[model samples]
Target chain A: GESVGLHLPTLSVQEGDNSIINCAYSNSASDYFIWYKQESGKGPQFIIDIRSNMDKRQGQRVTVLLNKTVKHLSLQIAATQPGDSAVYFCAENRNNDMRFGAGTRLTVKP
Target chain B: GAGVSQTPSNKVTEKGKYVELRCDPISGHTALYWYRQSLGQGPEFLIYFQGTGAADDSGLPNDRFFAVRPEGSVSTLKIQRTERGDSAVYLCASSLNPGGHETQYFGPGTRLLVL
Candidate 1:
């Protein structure tokens, strides 16, 4: 069985500060990892992804780190803004199927 | 240029009733997926379609859930004898192909409320 889980259910950070959301997966065979941001009344939006062969991938202000050795994944948002407030999820893709974590609600305070 | 679109943005049905949710993927997309998201939870995979056939449906909770992607363009998810537990946001996503590495573009989703 494959399970993806997040360390923090909710996180609050001051605007302009860096935000990091952590995720842990049980399947060591998993290869692909993706990060998504979902706002209220909307579907999950793809942010970035990292493959098992890669340890890190960056896009714009977001970076995804994948540690296959520990089955850990993380999404880092730099200079977070109020609009960045949303529920962030990490999904592990294995065999063309993706398993998502519970999600971490990120709140950026003014 | 339009993203994926879902019909009946919101659906309210009673227990034991049947419900069908529709999803229109982006043009030229060869892979489509269905997911269910409960309150305060991340979206859970329900099914995936490559072209007109179901590539994988292992995520379906039970026999009560079914989906189809005829013509390899549009897909419909059918729920039989819906239960209160069936209430959730039904999300549809599509990628360029069946490749596991492609990014999946999602729709707004259809909110299903089974009373």
Candidate 2:
């Protein structure tokens, strides 16, 4: 019954601007969360991950924030570029299995 | 050799047909996973293999779906009596360890279309 979901189904942002995508998970026992980017016709690529023990984690130009109390997760991309345009997914790791969210389609327009 | 590779980048089969998808993980990786991705949706976990044995296959939808990793390396996912709903992209991933927390490297995935 564990499921990961997102707040926004799609998001459009201007190039060079910051973008924030949110996700919600249904499992409290999940110990780890990850973010992935999938371009069309390609598999999902690992972006960054955060442990339940940590509230925030940063990688490259992206930052993942976890709020355990509300079971909410967020991914922030600084100065987003056109190449950042893709479907971003949030995944929760529980019982050695990873469940992915419905994903948010991020469109960065020039 | 560097990343996971799936065979037959695309497959089209009719209903009630049997199809086998193959996945070759990165060398020396100890864990492999299979997932199904429907149109406009995120990937759904189908099964997980640790070494040569399947650690978890509870995610497999029904008896029509099965997979095997005999030598702890290459894997094959078999589906019997496939239906229209079986159409989806099958993804395979591998990690260095069998733990829940590890960076998974994914393949390009095989697109299956059941007509």
**Best candidate, TM-score:** 2
**Model 1 Cα shift for residue A77 (angstroms):** 0.8
lDDT of 1 by residue, A14-87 (tens): 99999999999879988888999999999999899998999999999999888887889999999999999998
Leading candidate by lDDT: 2
Question: Relative to the true structure, how large is the alpha-carbon lDDT of every model?
Answer: 0.92, 0.93
List residue ranges in candidate 1 displaced over 4 A: A1-8
Q: For model 1, how does the per-residue alpha-carbon lDDT over B1-115 read when each residue is reduced to its tens digit?
A: 4999999999999999999999999999999999999887788999999999998999899999999988999999999999999999999999998887889999999999998
For model 1, what is the alpha-carbon lDDT of residue B62?
100
lDDT of 2 at B35: 98
Q: Report how far residue B1 has shifted in candidate 1, in Å.
A: 5.1
Clashing pairs in 2: none
TM-score of chain B of each: 0.98, 0.99
Candidate 2: fnat, from 0 to 1?
A: 0.71
Q: What is the C-alpha RMSD of each candidate to the true structure, in Å?
A: 2.7, 2.6
